[model samples]
Target: MDMNTTPVLQLTGICKRFAGIVALNNVALSVRAGEVMALIGENGAGKSTLVKTLTGIYRPDEGTIELAGQPVRFANAQDAMQAGVTAVHQETVMFDELTVAENIYVGRQPCRGASGRIDWSKIEAEAEKLFERLEVALPVRARVKDLSVAQRHFVEIARALSQDARVVILDEPTASLSQREIRELYRIIRQLRDAGTAVIFISHKFDEIYEVADRYTVLRDGQFIAEGALADITEQELVALMVGRTVKQAYPKADVTPGEVLLSVENLCHPTEFDNVSFELRRGEILGFYGLVGAGRSEVMQALFGLSTQVRGNVRLDGKPVCVTCAADAIKHGIAYVPEDRQHQGAHLTLPILQNITLPILSKVGFFLRGRRAEENKIARHFAEQLELKAAYLTQNVSELSGGNQQKVVLGKWLATNPKVIILDEPTKGIDIGSKAAVHRFIGELVSKGLSVILVSSELPEVMGLADRIVVMHQGRIEHTFNRGEATPEMIVSAASGNELAEDCA
Candidate 1:
């Protein structure tokens, strides 16, 4: 823990492979106490694979891992944690039925007095103490299932902190967080570093790294490419190192004439999650919904797409009244939705990529029970090509692809449905810049073909560049609508935060 001392962790000559895929090839990384060492690479570039090897999700094929100058091999994640290492992954793994406190201290619960029973009150009190230290305001007694994604993540971090970990790895922690939550997480990370914890942060976002990381290590094609102090490189240069090329503008935007209203929602209500929301999506127009997490944006999209059963709304498609009581009804009315959580609601991970794409339109192709293999393959191949999906073959499992490729599967699946209205929720999350651009361009093409798009995104720049018109939401209500020229990052943020436009917020 000395200021001028050795790194807390060092990995040299790390190599890993799965079947024929060489995931990490001699990757080297080091993390120092009181510093945030950012490990960044595109999806499938051995970032998660490397972390898994270190945390015992996979044993490295060849490598030397040292903690505090002594070599060590983690037999499992629990072994790593006991050895003062912990990781919070992109997806949270918490016991939903348990209380937040119980989830935080699942393995190491405090003992009660004479009865020798698990002390539930003590558990809640200890969790509250942890929350106080991390400045995370989560209800300790609340069921983990009731918490938002961001709150669950904070619980994970609090658990790690409670363990007094020497090295903590946070992988894409901000992916589900709002702007306010991101700033809060940054403060907590700074606190962790100041307390002498070596933080190994991983993210695809460049701006966040420069904001919070002290040193950066770039991995390319499963090999270490660069490592140095953050001050030594600019954002553009840092991106070049991480990606091995220049990334131009994020999206391909062109002027598209707005045609007739394709989809109209009036008095839409999902009584359980969100209520009283209304908006219009015009043909050849991208309508963006921007708000903080829990702003009910995704809920509104779900209601429109017929996922929530309690939805009450008047929906008009091409000026004709439509009641979407179920997903089939929505699809029958030419509506498609790509949900926010890809792992849970989007793709059928156990199935093949080809099956996922063609599953929606199988009946339409006149193939119901069996012997539809040829038609299914054709439909999948067409969309795979259109979306630039990279896969060894159509038969590959959907879960085997990287996050970006998995997202492509989701888009291709909905696109195969051939709907007039497409609703996308956080479509580009965890995807690389190239893939993000490709996805955005595909949205442009969809709108160009007279398809209406309702885009829900947390990235302000993305919304600014892609949306022809933006409808800001706050506290489950539409705050204000802005044309592309009228919206700025500041203005949109103000609206999303439920503040009157800053120029008039008084």
Candidate 2:
């Protein structure tokens, strides 16, 4: 990385506000050419606001932005792109109906001879070249709707590269990627650095920052806290800077004695997804399900939650057989599920936080909210305070909150249902360390109150730290089950990978 060159992108006194609430206060950042700068912050600490400001989605109320030592401002996204600045966001924004090649070069297609007709062949050829440069195999003619999450991210990166962008902002690029895809993305970031591109990498994972970033910029409560070389700072110091205190542990488990079984699933079978999946959740206990990407853990949970059809299973609550054929049936049986895809399945983003929290309980609180606004506000405020939700007000739209706050809203929605069993699938997947600790503490608090939990996670540390017992699945079948004191990381990973350990290994 070149250190002596002038910064490719620099911001000074960047201040932004929404309805008189400060989102960014005198936030400043600088990124030199050929270097990876890690933008570190907790959710709602103004990282997303800063990214939007840089990408031209939102104009700063007070600030000066300079590119290559020249003052400039972008009126819109197109203007920012034309000025050699681009951002590949976590939530991909692209036309699902368009092919990959078309999505990459949507507006700027090469023109034909003098007639200036659309040149389809050149577009596909250029897209193929870009994929080849990145050493990824993707069908250029395939529609983006059929692509996976990682594939969509690759398409966004290709688009950025195709535009010859000098400054690239990758916001949580690896959040949805598998381990192998994450390694590939790391290589791509290094390639961009080698080619003299200024990369602003934003992620909640510390190991990723330490691996790929050369410098660090920390934000705390909408203000700049620190900026320096990554090599000179320890991970502990960075966490302290971002959250203003020491987070001693990412997973905090509470001690609660397991009671009799509260929920039992026997021979849970989903046609073509999973076979003979069985588990027991006792009151005050957290039963964890760990597996690889396609291990069918989520499929089993979805079927149990009545989201899948043709599911053959016998579920009992407190030793009484119950029938759950759909979402409403499951809710009636005191079962609540927090889905992994929070945006699509968990929270109603267009609704206000108060409305979302009280949605599941509309049967009790009349749908006509004209006379029941006070009741709705009381319920929402109780959960919001319990979750420590950082939002402007109960009437604030869920879409306006950050990722962590959005997840909290979803969680509050389910908790408002007051279910006996809550199934949390990857609850803290994309949130930062501070928010993760808060969630872990909340989980402990839930179990202490005698609510059984079914935690389905791909992260090993989370499962091992919080689960009273773990059920490891491999290829849609139970590979092993380990008691709390018997499981090790190696044993659990091996089981998840379909490798059988010796009898004494655990």
Candidate 3:
């Protein structure tokens, strides 16, 4: 971890453009060996594009890339890998059926001397060595699909190390990991740094950045804002650089007194998922569900939305019993759900924004009999405008939009359904502070209009800020419920971590 040595990887005047949109403009970055350089930016801040360029996924329209004091131009990902530059993405790509060792050496397996046959034993031994080096205990013979999320990440890292990667880029590696898993990952990162590997850590969590990074690089709107030692700047200053302005209020929640109960669940149970879950949602109320990753918060929401078939519960809407057997039934009951995985469950990436937004209400738009484009546009435009979606046109593909804009599209689509009870799961996950504030404001406006919202989020600040009532879940049951004024971070966290002081706080 020498500071005086030359950077192992360097980029100068990097510019990347896509279909007339400038994704990265004159961005410069340098990563010295044996250091963890954190790449911090808001969503759509050109971080992904820069990483793509670095990995040869997308060639920069203009730039100079240097590796080990020599100019290098990678033709493709394989070319970059050969040059000792590799990236382990958030959504890991590996053959689920393959063994951990097989996946680690899939295409690059060592051949038996003179025999030209695959060397399986060597591969397993090598994977074992890599795991040992990372101080992680993982079976080399275990199937990839059988591994946990954290173990899968370890396999990805092992694969990168197998390629002898000097510059390893980790893209949002901790997004879905638990606190303990995150700590393990940090230890592995430090190990890599100590071994003289330049680690590029990309994340939105400021606490993680402060804890792990040795240096910081900020990107905003496709340009480099600043770079300095991590110890030289404060969190607020870093946030300001990423968003181009100080966020006056990260949570712009408006005060609203909830009215009569709109929806109530009694003894909701899903065999192996959650058990005996019960809650009430009042009119114009935002009820927040806070829990750890495996606390079964999302499972409860899924069951309530009719996505789980084995769910047993008594749901009363407006004091009347309602049975929702499927998503269609849930929709018919005036309950709309924005799923946690926006990319997979929320919106169709290949479809246009307008089409995605109008998908839920196609029949309402006369699409069953004779679809009217005008009607679809009108409905899509109304919600799109309301959500302030930033898109070039209604016909633009959702895949082309940024993470924040993609989330807005998902919200706009569900809002078009005009549901009385809307369930938003991790609504602002992976979005920037500015987008988060905008979403909070929108939620406030919705509740002001008498719309009841059920918010499920892993983020404590978001739940505390927007929820009028906080419901903490652990394992598979509701452990505690607290009114807005009564909840504290410590209590909520303790409950979420399965250390609830009481059986029921309510």
Candidate 4:
């Protein structure tokens, strides 16, 4: 093994296939000591498969993995870790029932005090020491379920650090974290790097990458397209490489003005989900609800759309009261919702795109046997073109398109209903910048067309840049509301975190 020249980990010509789909072909990456290598690609572009292969979750069909310049084959996750390779994924899984100390030291538990029982006191003390070292607030005895999502994520990171591995892989590490939490995570990562640990950061956030990554590796269509010093590449170039194409404009602004009040809610109260929620959505206005997870943003939207049972509110459409108790009622009132997790809830994977796209408006059609197919195709193609869907035809399976395109299909399905108000929940999750630009553009256009839009997004930039008026929520309560030129990212994020705003202007 070459001490000065050997990479910490070297992957050469990696190739993997899944059900006749060539997921990875001729992909290569080399990770050095004390450097953070960012692995970025579009969804289903083989980033997960590549990491799985490296961690022994999946074996590459062809390629060689060299650790310290010596070829090694990892039989399992444990084996990979033993060889100094550890991965902390997007979903951090641990025993909710286990104590923090036990969760951190799972496989190799600390010795008991000759009683053959787990040394609870020793475990707690050690856990406290680790938390202190990282400057993270965590109770060793606290139940995992009692902690917040961000806290649980930190616990997962603690477990990874406990492994004493030379290389760490983080997938979407900051997805659910607040800006403050993200800074803390970055601090810990830098601490790890300073300890000579090589970090592999995988995230869709461009700013986070530029701030932390030492090098950038871009993968597209399961193949390594570009790798360069992070400082050498511009953000635009990086985006282009990940998408493998040129992206035009984002925020496709359409010329629009308020036609009328499309939907108005007067003194809405769902005691369980929300209380005294009052708002009005005018035509061609995008009112974005900005809040941290569990701030009751989604719940309020759901209540208005008839998804919540305990909702008591006056929902009016065009100066007339409307009843909403279920999805059918919402549809009847010309309200469409593109939910979060489009794959899980919005699309039928086994069914073709046409079926999913038409499911919302299925009952409206007379089903003339002669022109049914042509009519369906025309409708699907029209919106698909508007969305710039990646698939070739309307009959293609929704499961085949990228994450961005799948989301577009979900929007298309709802758009088929000719809704007066559209509610989009985390509409751009797991999507690339190119696709994100497309979606922002589409939303701008839809709002311009006198379609009221209630957008729930975790991305601060999305909400701050696109929303006409921003409503900030904190702990199931409306903390503040900001009109145009007032709602900045700093204020929204601060308010969402339950902190007092510097300038309290509701």
lDDT tens digits, residue span 397-455, model 1: 98878888899999999999899889999999988776787798888888878888889
Candidate 3 residue-wise lDDT, 321-389, digit = tens: 999989999889899999988998999999999899989888787765655778878888887888777
Better candidate by lDDT, 1 or 2: 2
Question: What TM-score do all the candidates reach, one by one?
Answer: 0.90, 0.98, 0.96, 0.83
Summarize candidate 4's per-residue lDDT along 211-256 as a digit string, tens digits: 8899988899889898888889888888889887766555554566
Ranking of models by lDDT: 2, 3, 1, 4
lDDT of 2 by residue, 1-506 (tens): 55777899999999999999999999999999899999999999999999999998999999999999999999998999999999998889999999999999999999999989989999999999999988889999999999998899889989999999999999999988889989989999999899889999999999999999999999999999999999999999999999999999778889899999999889988879999988888999999999988999988888878899998879999999998888998888889999998999999999999999999999888887576899899999999999989999999999999999999999999999999999999999898888888889999999999999999998888999999999999999988899997977888988988886823486
Name the Cα RMSD for model 1: 3.0
Better of 2 and 3 by lDDT: 2
Distance (Å) between predicted and true CA of 228, model 4?
A: 2.2
- Per lDDT, the best of the predicted structures is 2
Please give the CA lDDT of all the candidate structures: 0.86, 0.93, 0.90, 0.82
Clashing pairs in 4: 252-441
Separately for all candidates shown, the number of backbone clashes (residues 3 or more apart, or on different chains) is: 0, 0, 0, 1
Query: RMSD of model 2, in Å?
Result: 1.1
